[model samples]
Target: MEKKPAGSSLSKALTMLNHVCTSPVPLRFAELVDLSELPKATAHRQLNTLLEHGLVRFDEHKQAYYPGYGLLALAHRTWANLDIRDVAAAPMRDLWSSTQETIHLAVLDDAEVIYIDKLESPKSLRLYSAVGKKGPVYCTGVGKAILAYLPEAKQQDIIHQQNFIRHTEHTLTTPQALEGNLQQIKDTGISLDLEEHEIGIKCVAAPIFNARHQVVAAISVTAPAFRTDDASYETMKGLVKSAADDISKRLGACD
Candidate 1:
């Protein structure tokens, strides 16, 4: 019969929501309680509040909780507010239509890259990245494209913070190795994924400059290795760079 402040209650609810969203799989009520470390009654009450608002949903068959459609609406609104995404939409569509490959638009955030827009290919196999998901800059094409244009100090800071966990044999696991690749990307104004993020998935990417002539975002074209090879990547590199240039011009960047 004790009263808690409104702020405390809101924090508890938000914490529980994040726990459910970040879990690798749908989480049971007891699992959420354990992860959130909140009292049983308090955890249940907060979960009910979120579920009622549709921020979270319960799976009856699996008896677990996952992020709901409500989050999708919020995500849509969030991306809609980004001018870069709006500006890049047309060029992204054009590039996707031309190549029939997946297209991704991302921006550097802290030491990682956050996917803001994604156009899925008709192919059966696809990249695991999704809008709102965060990926390592050292391993992803978009990440490397942005990193190549970042100031040296900023690049070093990001590289130093990375855990360098290898996702594939092709992944660059050391700052020295990644730096070499970054230099190459800077020289050519293009970057390659080379199955570094996931096996069978490869991409070519280029950075989009803002009105201030600073790298603000990156665009990439991704395909399965089964359908593409070294020569295809070289072709993709040109396409991606051209699309990026188009987006950059729309953003008011000068030659």
Candidate 2:
């Protein structure tokens, strides 16, 4: 039997943590072993270390390991420190005030759209999603808009890695289908979520670019299906696009 160096063991543990961070649910020990290609005993030892350090936690009932509360604390720290939030706050407020629809600001994390900020609509019949909620990059408007503008290799990598889980009848579950939709979004510079991720919610989204002309985030206006008729969709589409453009310009994205 051969023993790995301390540095190698630490690297493997970090690799396992990175894999779990992107997953939607906790993973079993066997799953981690297979994914990380580590010996079962080594994986177990690493898991125990992570658990003790509050970097990972075990679910007794589910028999799976997931990221611990410490990871969430770290995520909060990162979010609070990022300059994008400061750059986006004023524009986001303006978008919310003008549309009166639920406006969301999301960034890409592990190929998924992670909502960092949200402004709920004041209307009685408005659609709402939480700030910390994560959704597939293929079916959601914000996700698609950002993904469409990403580098081709990165987009392919994400499509290949993620399961593309179908949440509703309208969800695009296949890579080819999603690719086609992304192409359409790239062509039109707009994205739509027509009851794709959620059955009764629709969204209009546009990409926010950074100083390097890279799509760094997305802005969206979500509304209930009943209020998302053709005319309203068109109107909101233009509005969201304008807001995204404003944010991008502020971020120094130019022609």
RMSD of each: 17.8, 17.0
Question: What lDDT does the true structure give each of the candidates?
Answer: 0.91, 0.85
Per-residue lDDT tens digits for candidate 1, residues 67-103, read 9889878766754466998899999999999889999
Clashing pairs in 2: none
Off by over 4 Å in 1: 1-82
lDDT of 2 by residue, 1-255 (tens): 533444577898898887777788789988888888787788888888888888888899999988888886775676446587677788889888877889899999997889998888898754446788887888899999999998999989988877888889999999999999999999989999988988899999999997668899999999888878889889888889998998888776785
RMSD of 2: 17.0
- Ten-residue region with minimum lDDT total, candidate 1: 1-10
